[model samples]
Each structure stands twice: as C-alpha cells, then as structure tokens.
Target: MTPAEVRARATGPTAGLAEGYAQANLIAVPADWAYDVLLFTQRNPQPCPVLDVTDAGSPRTVLAPGADLRTDLPRYRVWRDGELVEEPTDVKGHWRDDLVAFLIGCSFTFEAGLRRAGVPLRHVDQGRNVSMYVTDRQCRPAGRMRGPVVVSMRWVPTALVGTAREVTARMPAVHGAPVHVGDPSALGIADVGRPDFGDPVTPEPGDVPVFWACGVTPQAALMASGPPFAITHAPGHMFVTDVPDSAYRI
Candidate 1:
C-alpha cells in the first residue's frame, strides 16, 4: 500500500508494506526535549538512527515531502509526563507548536532485502506483529532520556541465520545486525512466548530466535524518564517513507 493508502486506513502494522520503500519510527517531542532525544539517538545509533527531523511545530519531513506526520502512520501513542495517555489514529487534535518530529530508521526497511535473500519473516508469514521486548541491557542515556534497550524478535531457520545477518548488516541505518541469536534468557527476557509489545510469534522447529535493536527504544525511554509530552508510533506500526530501502543500504 502507498503512504496515502496507509493514511486512509490508519490502522494495522506496516511490516511488509511498500516492499522496497524505507519505513521509519516516529517520535515527536517538545522542542525543549528535542536536543536530548537527538543526543539519545546519537548515543544509541543501532536502534535509533535518525532518518529525518522536522522543524519545531511542523509535521513536514524531507523523507516524504508530501506526507503528513500527524496522520501518516497506522497508529500513534500519546504520552504525558512519561505515561501513555492515548493510542490515537490521528494526532492532529493533539499536535502542538513546540513539537519536533524525529523520523528514526525502522527494521521494516530491511525486511525486503532479507526476503529477497530468502530469509523468511515468520511474523509476516503468520500475519502477526513482530514480537518486541525490553532487555536488561540499558541504553546509554543522553540528558533527560534514559531506558533499557528494546529488541524486535524474528524466528529464522538455523541454516539461514547467516543470510539474515548478511542481508541486514548492510543496512545499518535500519538497525543493521542481530543483537542476539538463540537464548532469550541471555537478554533477561523471561518468556519467548510472551512479549512486552506486539504479538508473540511461535518459532517453528529448526528455527532460532533472533533479536534486533528496535526503534521503539525511545518509547521505553519515554516511559522511563518522564518527558512532559511526547508522540510515538505504536509498536509494530510505522511511518512508511518515499525513499527506497537501498538509499539506506551500504
């Protein structure tokens, strides 16, 4: 589907949508907090690569000049004082003049490359949102932003793990390589079947669990270090951009 189609529907996850186009994670915070968020992404590049940043009070982005950030994504999470207050399809009503929207690179941008390489995406195949979890590993803090690292899990056949790694490693802007393979307990995750966000995907026989740093790491930071107001794409949902995925591949 096109970004216009996604805006029209305003629901569901964007994984596998717009096959070769880059998709991004959205996080719009007050300008006062923008520098801190920018610094946080700089400190944690793998999970928070910045694709494009909008001017304060403006929803326009260079990544997709014609798209409106307030309504382009499938869903958004509104937060106040670090607590989630709403999950709205459109944030136009909640939009503020002091907001600075950051378009962070999303792993969905690299799935096409993986698919082309014959790496199966179990979540897409199962028709479910990718599983995400908060790891015991903490992200390096920047100013007022601080939180544990969050990771999206994919189940890959043991033999194809190398292919998955090679295909994704070239796209560092969209979270490059797998952070962990097999053993969820190593990441301090208690259950593989129960995720902190998104749906739990079942691992088929011969499949091993692979984890990648996720853009939702900012949402975890928002929950950890109470920012007065913030907006982020709901987990699994994302803002699809006009840029081709290859533009970000190295």
Candidate 2:
C-alpha cells in the first residue's frame, strides 16, 4: 500500500503496510527537551536510532518532503505529565509552535529483507502486530531521559536465526541485528504470550523467540521522565517516509 493509503486507514496500526517504504517512530516534544532527546537517541542507538529531526515547530522533514506530520501518521499518542491522555488519528489540534518532531528508525524497514531471506514474520503472516515487551534492563541515561529498554519479539526458527541476524545487520539505520536470541526470560520477559505493547503471536514448536531493540524505548523514557507534554506514534502505528528501504541498507 502507498503511504497515503496507509494514512487513510489511520485507525489501524501501520505494521506490514507500505512494504518498500521506510517507517519511523514519531516523538514530538517541546523544543526545550529536544537536545536531551537527541542525546538520548545518540546514547541508545539500537532502540532510538535517529532518522530525521524537524525544525522546531515545523512539521516538514527532509525524509518525506511535503508530508504533513500532524495528519500523515496512522495514529498518535498524546502524553501529559507522563500519562497517556489521548490516542488520536490526527494530531493537528495538538500541534504547537514549540514542538519539535523526531523520527526514529523502525524495524519494519528491515522486514522486507527478512522476508526476502526466507525469515517468516509470524505476526505479519497472522495479521497481528509484533509483540513488544518492556525489559528490566535500563538504557544509558542522557540528562533527564532514562527508562527500561523495550524490545520487539519475533519467533524465528532455530535454524534461521543466523540468516535473520545477517539480513537485519545490513540495515543499521533501522536498528541492525538482534539484541537477544532465545530465552525470553534472559531479557526479563515472563510470558511469551503476553506483551506490554502490540499483539502477541504464538510461536511454532520449532521457533525460538528473537528480540530487537524497539523505537518505543524513547516514549517509555519520556513517560518515566515526566515530560509535561509529548506526542509519539502509538506502538505498532508508524509514520511512513518517502525514502526507499534500500537507502538505509548498509
């Protein structure tokens, strides 16, 4: 589907949509907090890989010129004092002159490569969102931004784990490589069927769970830091960029 079509279906999550285009996680905060957020991303590149940052108060981004950040994404989450206040399909009403938007790399960009390499994504196959869990591990803090690491889990066949890693490792811009493979408990995940965000997909008997750092880490940090106001793409919902998937492949 085209990015516009994905936006038209704004109520649904963007996972598995716009196959060849790059998808990003959105984080918009007051300009005062931009530097800290940038530093946080720089420090935690795996989960918070920086893709683009808009000029303060402006929605235009080089990644997708002419796209409207306020209305282009599938869905948005509004936060007030770290509490979720709204989940809206459009954020035009919440757009502020002091808001700065940051686009972070999303693993969705690499799924195509995985599919090409014969690594099946059960979530996509089942029409469910990938499972995400908040781990006990804390990210490297930057200024006031600090929170537990969030991970997206996919069940990979034990034999294809290496293929999955090699395919994703080439796309460093979209969070290259797996952070953890096998044993979800090692990452403090108690139940494979339950997730803190997104839908859970059951693993086949021969599949082993693989974890990757997720863009939701920054949103978790923003919430923990108690930022007065913030906006982010709802988990699984993403901002589709005009850039091609190959542009980020290394």
Candidate 3:
C-alpha cells in the first residue's frame, strides 16, 4: 500500500511507505536544548539545513500542516545519555509535552529531480541504502553540538554529471549542490567500500563518485554529543510530508 494510503488505513508499522512526497530528517530535542540545536543548524546550512521547527509538544509542522511527527515516520530512535536505547516504530512512548521537533530536508527530495533528469541513482536502483560517511571536515560548532560532517554518496555517469549538478543545485533547501564530485579520498573518505553508514554502490569505469551533505547529519551529531534525551527518525524511514519539491527552491 502507498505510504499515504497506508497511513490513512492505519497508524501502525508501515508509517512512511508512501515516499516521494517531501521527506525530512527529524530531530526531537528536549525543550531546554532546542535553541542551541537550532543555532547549530543555522550555522551549518549545507550540512545541517533547517526546514522547520515545531513548538514544544507539537508534531504538526507548518511544512506539512496537519502531519503528526510521532507517528508519521515508520520508525524512530530514542537516545538517552547520547546512546541509542530503543528503535521504536512510533515515538508514542517517547513523546513528551516538553519536546520540540525539527524537520530537515532529506536527499531523496533531490533524487526525484535526478531521476527526472535521467541521472541514475544506483543505490535506489538496487534497492540498497545510499552510502554515507563521516568526513574529517567539521561542521561549524554551535552550543554543544559538533561533529564531522556526514555525507551521502552516489555514483553517476560522467556524461550526466552536469545534469546532476544542475538539478540538485536548484534545490538548496534540500541540500542542493554536490559537496564533492571526484575522488572519495579528497573528502578523506579512505575507501568507498567502507562506508560508516548505509551500503556502498559500485562505480563503473566512467562514473564519478558524488557526495552531498546528508539529512542524517543530525544523527551523527546526536551520537557525538549524546544528549540526555533525544529522538530521531530511523535512517531509511523518514517523514513524508505534504510539501512539494518546488517548495524547496532557494
């Protein structure tokens, strides 16, 4: 069933299956820590871009109007003392009246553009998660949040490089533009085969490795800081919102 259709039928496990709508990486922080994390996202717009921030205890975002944050995503990770303790299909048990949620655009938003542009995404084509790595590069620190910028990598044909560039460049709100376009080593990525998260994709002779700032940046930052209490969407499961791709232009 479609994610939206399934979501309508039941509020259970198949939470965000109807993807291709605008997807966002979610971060739920204790109210006291919300401002600091907001500052971090503001400082590093490329790696930790902000799409929306919800008032404490509210899951509905202006980005999607009536969408429910706690149940919209298929799964969530609950962290305590900076360590992941539970991977819940829904955050109902973790939800709190004092928590605030932030929604950041996911790379899938741009993948739609790439698919439209004919730039094949091997990871999605193969139904495998995109490869992501933590770079030696650091995001500008804000408050207590600081970590190496994490990136999601994809391989595209040499001939369609310009197409990949042009389409993604138009969607900065969803992490537009490739951060690195050639050698993986330039990004301090030792071996494309050894990714920190997600599976690796094969690079054909003429395909160049292209990396983008990932929506998962917050998860990496969360692990590094280890906040007292926080929640985030599971890696593959994301909130499919009512917004459209064109809404992210800027």
Candidate 4:
C-alpha cells in the first residue's frame, strides 16, 4: 500500500504494511526546543538516525511530498510536561505553528532487507507489533534532552544471526546493526516477555533474541526531560514514506 492508502486507514500498528517502503518515526516539538532535539539525535545517531526534518509550523516533509504529518500517521502521542496526554488518530487539533517535526529512520525500514536475507521476523509473522524495551544504558545527552536508550527486539535463528546483522549493517540510516544478540538481561531487561512498549514476541526454540537501537528513544527522552509539549507517532504506528527501503541500503 502507498502512504496515502495507509493514511486513509489511519489506525493501528504499521508493521508489515507498505512492505518495501521506508517508514519513519515522527517527533514534533516546539520551535524553541528544536535545536536541543536536533543535537540530541546527532549525539546519538544509532538510535536516532534522521531521515528528514520539517520547517517550523509546516506539516509537509520531503520524504513523502503532499503528505500531511498532522494526519498521515496512523496514530499520534501527545505529551505535556513529560507526561503522555493522549493518543489520537489525528493531531490537527494539536498541531502548532511553532512545532518542528523530525522524521527518524525506523528499523521497520530495514525489515525488507532482513526478509530478503531469509531472517525470520517473528513479530511480523505473528501479526503483532515488535517488542521494545527501555534499557539501562543512557544516551549521549545533548542540551536538555536526555534519557535511557530504548531498543526493539527480534528473535533471529541462532545460525542466521550473522546474516541478520550483515543485512541490516548496510542500512545504517535505519539503525544499521543489532546492539545485543543474546541476552536481554545484559540490557537490564529483567523479563524478556514483558516490554515497555509494543507487544511481546515469543521466540522459537532455535532462535536468539536480537535487539536494535530504536527510534522510540526520543520518546524515552521526552518522558525523562519533561519537554512541556510534544507530538510523536504512537509506538509501532509509523509514518510510511514514499522512499524505497533500497534507498536506505548501502
């Protein structure tokens, strides 16, 4: 499906949808805090690779021309004083003139490469959102933006772990490689079955859990820094773009 078609549906997680296109995580903050956000992403590029940044007060992005950021995404999270205020399908009522939006490269954009490499994607196959957990590791802070790094988990077969890494490593823009390939405990995750965000995915007997730095790291920062006001794509519900996944491949 195209972005416009995805926009029409306007609800639910985006995994496995618009299969070959690049998807992005959306985070729009007031103009005053734009510099901090930009600096934060630059300091922590692995979890926050930038795809596009919009002009203040504009909902249009070059990633998918003519698509409105305010409504194109399936769901949005509105935050105030570092707390989640709402999860709305449309953010038109909350769109602000001084808001500057950042489109962060999403791991979902790299799934096609993994698929082509024959690395199984359990979450996609199970019709569930990928599991995401907030880790104990802190991100390199820039200005007032600071938080623990968050990661998305996928259970790759023990033998295909290397294949999964190589396929993803070429696409650095969308979190190029796995941060952890074996134990979730190494990241301070006490329970592999429970996630801070998204759904839990069970691994098959021969599978090894693989974790990648996630775009949701911004949301972690949002919650930690108390940004006053912000807008983000609801976890798992990303903004599908017109760019092909190959565009991000090396």
Candidate 4, pairs of clashing residues: none
Q: Model-by-model lDDT, in order?
A: 0.93, 0.91, 0.81, 0.94
Best by lDDT: 4
The residue ranges of model 3 lying beyond 4 angstroms of the native Cα positions read 1-3, 6-20
> How does model 2 score by TM-score?
0.98
Relative to the unseen true structure, what is the C-alpha lDDT of residue 112 in candidate 2, on a scale of 0 to 100?
Answer: 84
Error of 4 at 186 (Å): 0.7
lDDT of 4 by residue, 1-250 (tens): 7767987784889988988999999999999999999999999999999999999999999999969999999899999999999999999999999999999999999898889889889999998999999999999999999999999999999999999999999999999999998888999999989999999998899998999999999999999999889999999999999999999999
Question: After TM-score superposition, what is the CA distance of residue 71 in candidate 3 from its true location, in Å?
Answer: 1.3
TM-score order, best first, reads 4, 1, 2, 3
Q: Whose lDDT is higher: candidate 2's or candidate 4's?
A: 4
Candidate 1 vs candidate 4: which has greater lDDT?
A: 4
Q: Candidate 3 local accuracy as lDDT? A: 0.81
Give lDDT tens digits, candidate 3, residues 1-250. 4445543444332212443556788999999889888998999888777888998999789877766788767678899978989988788878999999999988877776788788887887666777889888888888988778989899999999889989988888888899999888888999999889778778778898989998788888888887799999877567776777778865
- Please provide, for model 2 over 1-250, each residue's C-alpha lDDT reduced to its tens digit, 9 standing for 90 to 100: 7876776665677777889889999999999889989999999999999999999999888988868999988789999999999999899999999999999999999998899899998999998988999998999999889999999999999999999999999988898999999888999999989999999898888999999999999989988998899999999999988899999998
Clashing pairs in 3: 3-18, 82-226
Taking all chains together, each candidate's TM-score versus the true structure is 0.98, 0.98, 0.92, 0.99
Q: Model 4's lDDT to the true fold? A: 0.94
